[model samples]
Target: MLVLLPPSETKHPGGDGPPLDLGALSTPELTGVRTELVEALVELAGDVPGARAALGVSARQDGEIARNAELRTSATLPVLDRYTGVLYDALDVASLTRAQRARADARLAVGSALFGLVRGGDRIPAYRLSAGSALPGLPTLRAIWRPALEPVLAAEPGLVVDLRSGAYAALAPVAGAVTVQVLSERPDGTRSVVSHFNKATKGRLARLLATTTGEPADVVGLRRLLRRAGLHVEHAGGTALTLVEPAI
Candidate 1:
């Protein structure tokens, strides 16, 4: 199974791995797009004001632009280790056993505004970009990504669990992938879509899937896998799964 995860705005800086190498990443079809976007980012980074405006960041966040400037040369880490936030914090990859980590390296992939797509084991550098950002001299990111990303993702052989956030998901919609909705159940029995908690739940779910001994063949099998991991999952409909968590 392929688990598509969303990239985090925040990352753990500096890595022991070599610099970013697009050729080495999975989904070679995205190489051209990734190179184009990276070049745009590096060029824009030359103009602090332009970069800040394009990236939707404040003056204090100019450091992010600097990071973008060094995208190609910066030391790198596995994509899973590079990103950090609610979802990644919950995934807690650092704590996984060797076997579980190996499984994670095999099954996980991250959706990126910069790289287009990256596998868990793919080494990447700290860079600043968002799926919503419209870089100068480029069409809408979604437009640039869809044509390139969709076909690559569509070619995946088995069940795909897409946990990308809205904007990243829009970058490339997986035709029949199972999408998850995280809901927090209240004491009164009402459930509401969660934001912060949603990421955490998805992270936990990804960890579980990564560690599972057997790959799930279909949605039913996926439900069984998650259930075995102690998560409350319900089939919402075709290509949809609702994960209910206690009110937080």
Candidate 2:
């Protein structure tokens, strides 16, 4: 039987600092508090089953504490990025101090477990194979790119393109914006590009256009349009969009 503990205050034994006055701190500060709590819980729980059970209870209690702290720190966190719509608070990892980074890493592990639960049984495929290389198969490769585009395209009605120059470009007609960036490369010397749609490229005949655009420009809308147009959109990242017929 699973036993859940009631929320309670358990002071940090080290007394590093009073339960992180998150209300007075920044998002980075709140992240630090969260990291500390995770570390303390992990230490307390150790490797025993009983410790694991206790840690679960501690996590639930601390999550509420962290949320409350975040509310106080919300004013300090940056606003969501205009293009991607991903919350700046969620992406504030780079601003954390080294100690904070360690703590954040532990919290991230917990968060990953939560994501796994919400995804049901679908495991994020291991991109690297046993031979220290990317796994073979076009279908798997396509799957990798789909998720990367889904969230971004859903938030902004545009195409994400990976350019040959090893940069990513996000084009949006609504904001009249085009951003290009270079993504990291794999050990095997493969680079990726991601481009979004804008007025300049919207009417162009392109594979990504065939796969991701329609009259309205949203991903779901474009998907329906692609189906009606009898086009198959594969998941080969930039390669898929590059293959479409050129615009006249």
Reference-based lDDT, each prediction: 0.91, 0.26
Return the TM-score for candidate 1, rounded to 2 decimals.
0.97
RMSD of each: 1.0, 18.7
- lDDT tens string, model 1, 77-129? 99899999999999999999998999999899999998888988999999889
Q: Model 1, residue 228: what's the lDDT?
A: 83
lDDT at 2, model 1: 95
Stretches off by above 4 angstroms in model 2 are: 1-30, 54-219, 225-248
lDDT leader: 1
What local lDDT score does residue 132 receive in model 2, on the 0 to 100 scale?
11
Worst lDDT 10-window in candidate 2: 110-119
